[model samples]
Target: MAGLLDIVDQAQAIACEDILKVDAFLNHQIDPELMQAIGAAFAQHFQNDQIDKILTVESSGIAPAVFTGLALHVPVVFARKLSGFYGENVKWLPFADMQNSWWISILITLVLMGLVSLLLALNGFFRK
Candidate 1:
C-alpha cells in the first residue's frame, strides 16, 4: 500500500480538478511493479468483501485489473470496444426549438443513454 501511495504522491493532477493524470505509471506508460503493487493493495483492501470478479475498461485498466484478479484469485472482465474507444455517435446536443418553445434536453439525454447502452452491448459482443 505504501508503494502505491508513494507513487500517487509523486503523480500530479494536471489541467482539471477531477483528473489525476497517472500516465507515467499505471496509464499510458506502464510500470509493472507499481501495477502489481496496486493490484496487491486492492486485494488487501477488499480481501474480506468476497469479490468474485473484476470489471475494468480496456487499455490502462487491464494491468491493474489483471493484478487484482491475480491476487484475489478471481476472473477479470475486459471491456473491448467495437465501434471506437469512446464509441460512435457519442455526443450531446442541447438544441433549442423556437417553434416548439422548448429545449430538447430530455431527448438529448435519452439519445445519449441509448448510445451508451448500444456501445456497452457492442463492446461486450466484440470482445477479442
Candidate 2:
C-alpha cells in the first residue's frame, strides 16, 4: 500500500496491492551507481559555476559530497556532528546561527568565498 514514502519518492508506477520498499536503496542498501548518478547530476548542474570545494554534513551527506568532489576535481569538507576530537590542521569554525538566520548567511558566505578562490586560482593558472 502506498503511503508517505511513496509520496516522498514521487513514485509513478505502483500497484494498489503492492508495497514499495525504499529502505533497501535509500536507508539500508547503499547503491554506488545510484550515488554516482546523483553526484554526476549535481556536478553537471553546478558545472557552470566556479566551485572550489564541496561541503556537507556528516553521514548521509558524505557519499554525495565525495562524489561531487570527485566530479568537480576538488576537496570536500564535512562538519562534525559533535565536537570531541579533531586533528590540528582540521579547522574548527564555530557556526553562529540564531533561528537559522546565521546558518544560511554563513553558508552563502562560504560559497562565495569558494567561488572567489576558484576564480582566482583559474586566473593564476591561465597567467602562466
Candidate 3:
C-alpha cells in the first residue's frame, strides 16, 4: 500500500552492514553497468547544452570524468592537484569528492552557472 516515494525513502533509511560496506568493485572497482548509467544521466542532464569538454580535478574524479566524457563523446581533462606558476588559460572550478576521492572539489553552483552561460551564448550563435 506504500507509494513509490515512500519505498524510496525506506530504501534510503534501511541500514545493512553488508550493503553499506564499500567494496573495491562498486566504486573504485568500476562496474560497467553503473558507469553506463552514470554516463547516461550526465548526458541527459547536459543534452540541451553543447558541451565541448569535461573537466575535473585529478585522482578519483577520473572515474566519473571518464563516464561523463563517454556520455559527451568528448575528451576529458583533469586539473592537476598541484598547480605551477604561469598557469595557462586555466580557470578554477569547485567540485566535491567525498571519501577522499579527489584532492579538489569544483563548486557545483559555479559549474551550473558556467554551463548556463555557455548554453545561452551558444544559442545566440546558432540563431544567427
Candidate 4:
C-alpha cells in the first residue's frame, strides 16, 4: 500500500517536532477508503489465521477495526478507555498504568498481539 504512506505523508501534520497529528484522515476526520485499504492489508497478512474477533479501543480504533472485521468476517470487540462513576460496574483489565491516551492504545495493541501469539502457540500454528 504505497498510496497509504503517501496519504499519511500528505495529510499528517507535525507538531512540536515530535508529535504527529493525523486528525485530518486517520484519528479524527477519517477517510473511509484509506481505512478499507488498511483493513484489506491486515486481512491479507492474517488470512491464514483463524481470526474470531478484532479487539480495539473505542473512538479512533472503531473505524479501522470495523473495516478489518468486515474484511476478515469477524466480530469487533472495542474496549472502553474511560471508566464510569461506578468503576466496579465496568470490567477493567489492569494491564498497565494508563496515564497517556497514546500509551493506552499501545498497551491494548500489545495485549492483543500477545493474546494472538498465545493462541497461535496453543493451536500449534507456530510449530516449525
Q: Give all candidates' CA lDDT scores.
A: 0.76, 0.67, 0.61, 0.80
C-alpha TM-scores of all predictions: 0.59, 0.48, 0.45, 0.61
Model 1 sits at a Cα RMSD from the real structure of 6.8
Instruction: Give one digit per residue, the lDDT tens place, for model 3 in 17-87.
Output: 44442233234465565556667788889998978877676766677678978988988877675555333
Tell how far residue 124 is off in model 2, in angstroms.
17
Per-candidate RMSD, Å: 6.8, 9.7, 11.0, 7.6
* Candidates sorted on lDDT, descending: 4, 1, 2, 3
User: Among all windows of ten consecutive residues in candidate 3, which has the lowest summed lDDT?
Assistant: 1-10
What are the per-residue Cα lDDT tens digits for candidate 1 across 10-63?
775253867667887866778889888888989999999878778788888899
**Per-residue lDDT for 6-123 in model 2, tens only?**
4436633244557655444445555566667777878999999888877687777788788888888878878676765433455644443357866776787799868966986788
Model 4 compared with the native: what TM-score?
0.61
> Tens digit of lDDT per residue, candidate 4, span 1-128?
79776886887566657887778887768999999998998999999997887878778899889999999998887867667633458465564355686687677779987997798779975443
lDDT, model 2: 0.67
Candidates 2 and 3 compared by lDDT, better number: 2
| Runs of candidate 1 exceeding 4 Å displacement | 8-19, 84-92, 95-128
TM-score of 3: 0.45
**TM-score-better candidate, 3 vs 4:** 4
List the candidate 2 regions with Cα displacement exceeding 4 Å: 1-23, 83-128
In Å, residue 95's CA in model 3 sits off its true spot by 23
How many clashes would you count in candidate 4? 0
TM-score of 2: 0.48
Show pairs that collide, candidate 4: none
